[model samples]
Target: MSNVVARDIELDFLDHDFEFVGSENVSTIDSTYASQPYWKDVLSRFVKNKGAIIGSICVVLIIFMAIVGVGLNEHTYDSQIIAHQNLAPRVQGLESLGIFDGSEKMTTSSGTVEVNKYVSANGSVTGLEDTYYWFGTDVLGRDIFTRTWMGTRISLYIALVAVLIDMLFGLSYGLISGYFGGAIDNAMQRFAEILNGIPNLVIVTLLIIVLKPGLLTITFSLMITGWIGMSRIARAQVLKLKEQEFILASRTLGARNFFIIFKEILPNIFGQIITNTMFSIPNAIFTEAFLAFIGLGVPAPMASLGSLISEAFKSFTTHPYMIIPPVIVLAILMLSFNMLADGLRDAFDPKMQEM
Candidate 1:
């Protein structure tokens, strides 16, 4: 059997050619691959996702606009022009590009303030004020353009701060709880459950009632129960990671619990934490908006997207523009966050990365 198996095998005449040609003709197969870090692989996959790239660009643009749009505008968000009250959004000529001014002015020292230029049947001018309301004016005649941008800034800030708070508290809480299983884990998890059981909105309402309605108050309220969800997620990840071979190996090596938990386990869960944060930000934004819409948000003179929508609801029939802009902004923000989070999840997935 061995002699027959070793006998020279020959194929009948075929279309294929087998010859000792140049080195280029000889194909060498290699299964070995160069070492590549985890994060590099994640980033390479992340940028390749079209939806995520577009969403990231949009988010960056929104952030930039939130930071710079109001600064470039001549009008202050709070500045009111009674003469231009309830004016509709109008983009005349190059006004949209900021190259041309479209304003109507009225002197406080003078008489009857006017609006858009009008010629009566008698050919006499009725209203004429040189004031530009680019996004038109709110009922108080404040610039919607500046106010919307300002609200964007505030909302983005809240999302960032709230997420940071959640990450700091949640990561630590979960790590400690999961790393040290048994009675300690049970106690910590029960504590988190107790906190989560209390409705966050109810807590927010109670806090707002106790404290004044302001940005700081809103922030504190949102952050109260927000970290619980993240903590649970982190705890789950740590629970899974702690039972792994490497963790046992580290324990055998006499590594400290803190070092093992942070240095060994935490790095493995970093991507998951980031993805969770991205997904959580939109929820935080929506919470702020909801609070603001019900008049439980920032106080007077300060405009949030929710507050703006509430104000717009009063004049919905007459001016729909007020509701449209804020709705669009909120929708875009939420969509971008969700898309980016999904992208990150796919990027960090080993199976998906392989695909």
Candidate 2:
């Protein structure tokens, strides 16, 4: 009788109903989720950084001015008008504010008195007062406004070219040295070390002696030592990445060495490389400026911020305006690049991201 009862219960259990729940919602579930691309994500994070945003804007504006500002005024960067020498800043709209009114404090029999420099220098302010020298005139009577922007253009051009060449050589050297981990790596590293051991100043001075002091010479001097830093960074990154499982898988799949290094590994390390590149730009700019400052910069008629500052230093006591423009522009440019680099670093490295 117990066997019959157990058989009856088993039969009842087999008659239970089955239901498929939420099968229709399968595709709709993932609709609310959005996919973000790597670069897009980086841009999103970079935009969140206010300092980076401001720096980027400032950098863009400065570059734009460097390109276009030279043509804004009638005076060319090298033009000399002795009659207008050392004239104070005079702007059309701002003159009414009493500043940049082409006036300077003159020490005379009546003691120091603010006098219209244009009037004193030209003997009549009539037609001359209408003329505007936004940043004033330099000792050579060249418009400071035009010269400052022209100098900026040269400095930026030299820095960008040098850094780009450095990146190409450094990236190739590092990738090769790091990918092959034995004798080749050792030899390359030793060569890099020897190159690095020489002081940059010495290298630049020697180059100046060999080649004429100009944009090409300064750029070449920077390239000599600049690649070392980039190479080391690239090598370090490649060394850390080459032994990873993906690289091994690629190797196991018979990928060529070039393909493995560039196709597989390069994409992974590119962010770091770009961040380092950004950091390098300001250094190049500062170096060029320093070289120019010490009389090793571009020759006359071709202005650079460094050369501008050097020229302004002589009459800085009496004509303080000359030094202020270039100094301010240089400071802002360097600071902006640094800030942008800092932002790029944080954006690229997830570990460095703020909580």
lDDT per model vs. reference: 0.81, 0.87
Q: Which stretches of candidate 2 lie over 4 Å from their true place?
A: 1-33, 106-111, 120-127
Each prediction's TM-score versus the true structure: 0.82, 0.87
| Candidate 1 lDDT, 1-355, residue by residue in tens | 4554567878797556665678988789788989898889889889999999989998999999998989876788789877666675666565558432333333345654533332244667646333555677788878888899888987898888778877788778888998898999999988888888888778877887788888888778766777877888888999888989999999999999999988999899988888888988999899889989988888879888888888999987656666778888889999998999889989988576566
- Please write out the lDDT profile of model 2 over residues 33-62, one tens digit for every residue: 588999999998899989999999999999
- How many clashes in each structure? 9, 0
